[model samples]
Target: MLDSETKATETPEDHADELRLWLRLLTCTTLIEGEVRGRLRERFDVTLPRFDLMAQLDKAPDGMTLSDVSKRMMVSNGNVTGLVERLVESGHLDRRTSETDRRVQVIRLTKLGRAEFRRMASEHETWIADLFADLTPKDVRELMRLLAKTKASAQKSAARRRP
Candidate 1:
């Protein structure tokens, strides 16, 4: 729930270095996501969910089914349906039944949607770069490497938790 300007500033004295590292990673993620959400809303009048759905479609020009989007976005199908409806109404996307399967609703970004996403994506990159401007190239590379390791560890732990 922390905003971009806020972070996990309170830490117990007894916490281990791993705990501190996790908190730092979480704080950075929250800050960046919050900022990106705000910027997308302010500049494009769009919510992060809608923007993210569009991003998925942007990557797959062939389009995706409603359920496919739901899986990819880790959201409910109903959630994606509403966003798809709004985007379609705004003429930013097009939806049609799949040729082979009439039950499947395939969604894709229109030309206008592509252009709009490009604009937002360009600003998004600049915002991220600015946020990390304090980090030197070496620092960035080291962080990237470390984060990759952390990600693998987390994924392994998560897999172990699954039934």
Candidate 2:
């Protein structure tokens, strides 16, 4: 049987260790994301993108403009606009033109939206805890530290590539 680090088609002999590590990281992320998506749908009847958008708004109590939400969520404005439209239609979000700029639309969670998000967030925290239950506190801390370094390295590489 192949070990977790080894694939039948690509062994350590055929690929660099770094390539294997990247694949391992991607697989882990995909698996965890799929699980979380299923749980959010089953428990809250909400899609992950919708939940994610709400999460962004939850952080900004005063609310966020569509462009700001798009940037923060790392998505296109069109995607954010669609999410906002659905959320507003469901009465979970309030939309209004900015007082300072009529062309800028800002959105905030309604009372019901905040309340529901809080409830979902509380349970989501527990779900995350359960998902990582196998990792010890020290392991979690070490992974976090290493991932921070990895992020910094990636950002530096990206900066070098950008014009």
In lDDT terms, which candidate is top? 2
Model-by-model lDDT, in order? 0.89, 0.93
Model 2 error, position 62 (Å): 0.5
**Candidate 2: stretches off by over 4 Å:** 1-15
**lDDT per residue, candidate 2, 40-92, as tens digits?**
99999999998898899999999999999999999998999899999999999
Residue 150's lDDT within candidate 2 is 89
**Candidate 1 colliding pairs:** none
Across residues 1-163, which tens digit of lDDT does each residue of candidate 1 receive? 5653454454334658878888887998999999989998989889998889888999999999999999999899898889999999999999999889889999999999999999988898899899999999999999999889988998899999994
Cα miss at 41, model 2 (Å)?
0.9
Question: Which candidate gets the maximum TM-score versus the true structure?
Answer: 2
Please identify model 1 stretches exceeding 4 Å from their true place: 1-15
Return the TM-score for candidate 1, rounded to 2 decimals: 0.79
